[model samples]
Target: MAEEVEARTLSRVAWRFIPFLILCYFVAYLDRVNVGFAKLTMDTDLGLSDTAFGFGAGVFFLAYFLFEVPSNIIMDKVGARRWIARIMLSWGIVSGSMAFIPEIASAIGLSAEHTFYLLRVLLGFAEAGFFPGIIFFLTLWFPASHRARIVGYFMAAIPLSSAIGSPVSAALLGLDGAWGFRGWRWLFIVEAFPSIVLGFVTFFYLTDRPADATWLDPQARAWLQRRLALEDRRREHVSPSSALASLADHRVLALSLVYFGAVACNYGISFWLPTIIKGFGLSIAMTGWVNAVPYVVGFFGMIWWGLRSDREGERTMHLAIALALAAIGVGGSAFLADPTTKMIALTIGAFGVFASLPIFWTLPTAFLAGSAVAPGIAAINSIGNLSGYFGPFVIGWIKDATGGFLWGLVTIAACAVVALAITLALGHDPHLERAPEAAE
Candidate 1:
């Protein structure tokens, strides 16, 4: 009876928090990737060359890298509720502001090139802290054992947002001139408003910790608190100041390398996939709808991997195998000349790349606990994001130079192979073998 009751209670709490996390990420991702959709129109309208578009796209990660660690540390000090709300509201306003950049440039008589560059830089700074902040926030609610599945579910927001945004952007692009705005401008305006509203909702609904939550019954609250205490007690103690030292450890460094490779492939595909598909002579509207299919496949793939990882109680093997599959899938997409074959390959690649995300997060949360967990997670993510800059820039350069995406996909495949080797080498780390109790 007690076990059943506990399960039911936890399920209710999970339902509440998980969806909010997913929604927060959904908006974050929409802001992140809407630029991809916008590129379909904005590049031409703003007279941005291929290099300029790629640079602007990649710039978001530069700001993301600079602010990631500091933001996580701030979230740690101020609590998730306020920090996240602030990030959302501020970024939402900036996201909406992107709609007016072309006008601002025209009004100021700046060259078209300079205006787009300025807007992209500002957008990057606004969105800097979101992903790492969410990762740090998850530690407060879930134990190491439960975190992979939760992270998997949370990470699913990326694909889900893409799934929804692709068609919505397609629809918005079709609405060109409805309100005296270009389709891309409407895309920016329409997508951004939801984030501001969701930010207010987050402020109202989210609590920093279970102990701070008054909505739960006393029994439920006490039960959650006790379980979290036991989990926290099981881990070794390290002060927040020493957190960066973990980066010097071989195990953490190896994991960061793997993360770097995975993100390279992940973001490379995300930023370029629509353009790759459109190269096959599809219309912009069709390209938008078709772009959604791979992410739809990815959504299911993430759930399958997440549940399987939770059941198996392991991460390295799952990540390694998935990354290897991604290497083949993406490589095949690039190498194959047939449009149909390329679509199939792209869908397979999407599934493999996204499926590995939850497992990637699990490795860190499992190994690093308490105060060390936030900074350590942020550091890994911050370093891994270096690929975001490299991925898009390299892909754009390859496409421009070779007149094909084949070399770009091949490069990402090689990165995946390296990630696989790193994952295999990871078993020797004492961190992976430690009991969950010890992680606390």
Candidate 2:
């Protein structure tokens, strides 16, 4: 009876929540990273240099970094429904407007580069709290035993977007002569609409907590609430008394650096991989197909790895192993002059980098709770994502100065290794989550 109840409730919750959230994030990530696909033609259309484009792409993170913690804190105070709707609506407007930078620049008397930089930054601020907000929201519902796989499922949207959205983005690029606009213009406008529609959907469709989840059966809802409540009480025993103290917690600080390193490698690859593929003499359409390969493989790897971590009830070792794999794959690619070998190495690196992400969140979410967990999650994510700013900018600078991506690739790999070491040194607290027996 207990097993049946557990299975039924969890399955219902997963179906009720995960798929819709996945679609929302799918559109969110598509808007954010689609810039990579756009750059193929956008750079030429706007007369921008690689360095300038990198700065424009990466400047989004700076705004994201500045607003993330505050925005998340606000979400915690207000509710995910309102804040997320506002974020989506605003960013969709900004993202769609990206297609109009030239006209906007002419109207405002600013250079196109300056206009591009402003729009990217605004888009970042608009989208700031959404990711960490979702992660924190997951903790509110899922038990520690279930979290990694849940997060794995949610975070899978990242690569899945690239895998599926890349081809669509490529197709949009072919719309160059249609509607008196460039392909990148159509790409941004079409992609931006889903987010706006979804913002309204989020406002109406999402319920804030289990008590409010009217769609669930009464018995299943009660069971889920009990399980989640038990987990939260367990967490409160270790969580700091106030949310403010979490801002300075040593573990939070350490995790921030660890995330910084891993994210540095992840975004470095994401923002540049299209260009890297283009360098290999593939046509633009072919680059999209090739770029999707690593991510398609990555989609399966992320789920399997997260499940392994959950089943074993081990966070640190799993994270360390993934980060180490990332280091090896990405760095090793730097030395391979042969196109096939280099692609193979990068594919391996992408699998690892993508896999590490979902498992990494399980650690902090395991121990922190009540008022503190909100700020702790925000701080870690906001600080950690600063690496996003550095990663692309440095790669672009190195590519410009050295006339190659070799050193840039090496640098990103080294960051992943550092993240691995940090994970090992600050291994997870066993009692903070489910016991091994419970996992079994």
Candidate 3:
């Protein structure tokens, strides 16, 4: 039937963009979290104290928060092809420069710790625009009804990146004397170059919008454009002024709080998990290998939750459930005496944390539409990233003061509870009146 063929055709087009987005996010996540692996060795090699290392790690979020909204707005105006390519290339260069920090510091007669700090800050600035820009780009390509699952698929890159990066980082770290550089330094150098190549590839392969996609046949293009227009009309008209006005809405404020709480708990666990496991008496290589397990579990969890959300056309309940699971996991890990119990708790905790990500991203795009959607999503994301700064600092400070991870894990659990409270308060419905012109 012609109808069936059209359905299949649309499905192919819808999914075509996903793989590229996944690759982009995979590299971004790897670049962001690679520091975790680097820290295991770099701390001693660079003479950084626990506090100093935490500060350096936390500083990335400060830069990320500062530029997130501006970057999203720019992506809206300049389009994804140029902006994303620029972001990838710039950050790749900065990421690779991380390899030379020690040598540069020695050459300049600065302390290794100070140089490391400086490099981290620079890396943060370079990577500031990436995640939010990707979110903004997604709005341009996918319809609202379909955004959550696509976002989930794209977000799966997070765990997948971790899955691949864990073993790769372990191998790199073991390459201590390969080419006159420590394994940690080589990790930065080798991991960062791929993004640069991908950046150039993106410029050629990615189209900013359906209107700009020249590869589609005339019938296909016409069909897609019509669908998009109808979908847009389902939503209420958000004038440019009204788009900005959404910032003043009470719901937006509440959602921001929920986002902050969620991100705090997520980053807190991400930055500290390996260290916590190592504290349980595992060797560095063993810890790295073990780290992949949670990420693998998390990948499956994210897929299951994402598919469920798409099928049910729901968001809040799943997010609340995920947060509740995370709270229990963190709380149990903090209190349970058995090592096996703690590891089980951590695996469940990662599953919960990752599972919530797609839902968290879906809410903002669902609530805010049109020109306002980009800024609204960016604002939520920017505020949410502040948790990145707070989470790491809180965990590090608690660990330094308490001489263990218990208080820190408890603090993260408390944050998860706050996230749950906010989610319940926000309710489940998508608030925006769908623009009729939007693509279904």
Candidate 4:
């Protein structure tokens, strides 16, 4: 009866939250990266060089990195629903404003470069807390053992957004002349609308904690609350860290490097892959479909990888292996002459990079508990996301200098290798995952 009740509770929680959160993240991510699709025409239309566009695209992360930890800490104090609603609404407005950078530049007598950079920085600030806040919120509701798979389900939205959004964004590009708007402008304006709508829905729908989930029966709610509390006490008993200590912890620092390497490649690919596809001489719509193929593969890869880690009760080897795969795939892409082969190589890279993400979270939250959870997740994410700024900017510079993306792909691959080495050395403690009953 107890086992049955627990299963029912888990099922209810997953059903209640997972799909909605996926939708929320899907909207957020699509808005973030649709800029990739926009770059196809927007670059030429705005007279942007590769380096200039890269600077604008990458600048989002500079602002994001600066504000991330503080935003997350505020989320912890004010609660996830309010914080996330604020994030979605504000970013939606800023993202929509990206469509008007040229007109705004003309009116203010500012350079388009400065206008692009400014809006991106604002978008970054608005979206700062959404990702890690979701991660930390999951920690509040789910037990450690279930986190890898749960995170896998949620983070799969990353690829799904890219895959599905690719074609949709392309179609919006067809709206080029409607209302005297360019297709890329239409893309930004149309994509930005959903987030504002979803933000309002999120505020009303999200239950802040298990105790507040009145939709659940008393038995299921009580079981869930007890399970989460016990997990918290167990983790705090082992590694009890305050928020400040977590930021300074050596393990967290090391993990941040791994995350940094992973994101560098992730964002580098996201911001530039479409341009590389366009180089194949396909139309805008065809490029969107072609670019989506790898992310489709990656969607399954993340699910399989996360579940395997949970079943094995392992962390280190899984994270290390994932990084190695990404390093090899991305590094090898530079050497391939055939575009088809290059796409396949990038697909392999996508699998490893995306697969590594949810499983990576399992490591940090495994030991770090108490007040540390918020700032710790925030610190690690903030440091890692620094790559979001550097990766694209550097890649753009290299593309202009070398006349291609080969060496740039090679550079990002090296970052992946650095990550793999750290994960191999850090090692995982099975004790951190041991349930309190087992320890007792």
lDDT, candidates in the order shown: 0.80, 0.89, 0.79, 0.90
Clashes of 4: 0
lDDT of 4: 0.90
In TM-score terms, candidate 1 sits at: 0.93
Writing each residue's lDDT as its tens digit, candidate 2 over 1-440 gives 86798888788888878999999999999998888899999998888888898888889999998998899899988988888889889989999999999999999999989999999999999999999999988887777888889999999998899999888988899899897999999999999999999999899877778888888889878877877777777777778777898988888999999999889988888889899988999988898898898888778889999999888888888999889989999999999989899989988998898899989999898878888888899899999988888889889999899999999999989999889988998888867786234433
Query: Would you list the rank order by lDDT, best first?
Result: 4, 2, 1, 3
| Predicted model with the maximum TM-score | 4
Q: Which stretches of candidate 1 lie over 4 Å from their true place?
A: 106-110, 237-241, 428-440
| TM-scores of the candidates in the order shown | 0.93, 0.97, 0.93, 0.98
Best by lDDT: 4
Ranked by TM-score, top first: 4, 2, 1, 3
Q: Write the per-residue lDDT of candidate 4 for residues 141-240, one digit (tens) a residue.
A: 8888888899999999999999999999989998989989999999999999999998898899898889889999999898888877887787876553
Clashes of 2: 0
C-alpha positional error of residue 33 in candidate 3 after TM-score superposition, expressed in Å: 1.1
Q: Which stretches of candidate 2 lie over 4 Å from their true place?
A: 435-440
* Model 1 lDDT per residue over 1-440, tens place: 65665676578678989988898899888888788888888888888777777777887788788887788888889888888888888788888877888778889898777876676667666766778778777777665667678889999999999988888987888878987999989999999998899888878788888888788788878877776666555554532335677656566677778888888888888888888888889998888889999999999999899889877777778888889888888988887889888889988988889998998887776556666777788788888887887888788888888888889889978888898898897762333433344234
- Superior by TM-score: candidate 1 or candidate 4: 4
